[model samples]
Target: MKKIEVFVEKANDGTYWGSTQNLPGGVSSYGNSFDELKQNLKAAFKDYLEVGRKLNENWVQEIEQLTEFEYQLDIASFFKLLPIKISAIAEKTGINPSLMRQYASGKANVSEKRAREIEKAIHELGEDLLSVSF
Candidate 1:
């Protein structure tokens, strides 16, 4: 089974929302938290599948085979959920702290390359944490 690509964002009200890219209409869902968001997305996609099967839509075949949702977050939402200090991560990654703050707060657009850099830094941190003795 393939994974459904879901773009997630945190709303002004602090609720989480996500949507599956490309469909007859659009498979979108919202929740107050990440767990709720996944639950709602599953429900919404199930509804989408039923409708797609009924209408005999071509996209349904590929979509219905998907059992996993790959949720990618915008920078702001990522920081909000992860609770990691943007400045610290920026310093570690050699990305300007001010620019990182802007990206974290959704005040600036982050390029794909920049996003990958940030992700790499976080993953390296995770690896460092794994080396802890206890």
Candidate 2:
């Protein structure tokens, strides 16, 4: 079964948003809470996959097994889901370890620009991994 990576993020308005990087453009979902976001993302993903399958005959087999597709949280969401040390993420994103720790522990508020920087790093890493053929 193939895995679909979903990047979940907290929006500026305090809402949650989720989207798959592997899917075509415009496939996204939003919610007021993480639970709502999860449900919305699942439904939105299924709908998006259906539309994709309709446009591509070769996707029929995959579409038929859509239930088998695994959904995973990426980067920030992963960190939020588990108890990961901020130092590790800081090393990966090239941010100051102390500041990262503060952010992770809710001791320091991250500005939008800094948040974008962290996100950009994650996306860049994802792109690099995607370029590798297994």
Candidate 3:
């Protein structure tokens, strides 16, 4: 068995969403509460594992490798903290505020570029705060 870390976040619309950091399409259900979201994610992971097992191909190993990647990054806590506001993130990343809000609220799909921008912004913020504290 492989271990994968799941991160959950509460969207602005009062729903919860979660994903595994290393799995490209490993995102799970969006629900009105954390427990509901977790339950849905459990079901999703079970189905994913079962499908991989049924396929009887190298896909199961691939998924295990992906989970390993996630473990290396220690991204399980990525969604645990909401450090930056959508407006601030938009201002920093030059992304539209509405789009940022939509992405943060889980109302819209995050484009690759947008996701990169968000990641960059978060990284910069983390570095800055660390520098200030140190």
List model 3 lDDT by residue over 1-134, tens digit each.
Answer: 45666656665576777787655457566667666776777678768877777977566766745433122211222343344576777898998988777776556777777677778887898888888843
Off by over 4 Å in 2: 24-26, 63-100, 103-134
Answer with 2 or 3, whichever has the higher TM-score: 2
Ranking by lDDT: 1, 2, 3
Q: What is the lDDT of candidate 3?
A: 0.64
Q: How close is every model to the real structure, measured as TM-score?
A: 0.83, 0.49, 0.45
lDDT of 1 by residue, 1-134 (tens): 45788999988898999988755577999999988999999998998899889999988888777788888887889999888988889998899999999999989999999999998998899999899995
lDDT of 2 at 38: 78
User: How many clashes does each candidate structure show, in the order listed?
Assistant: 0, 0, 0
Clashing pairs in 2: none
Could you tell me which 10 consecutive residues in candidate 2 have the lowest summed lDDT?
A: 66-75
Ranking by TM-score: 1, 2, 3
Clashing pairs in 3: none
Give the better candidate number (1 or 2) by lDDT: 1
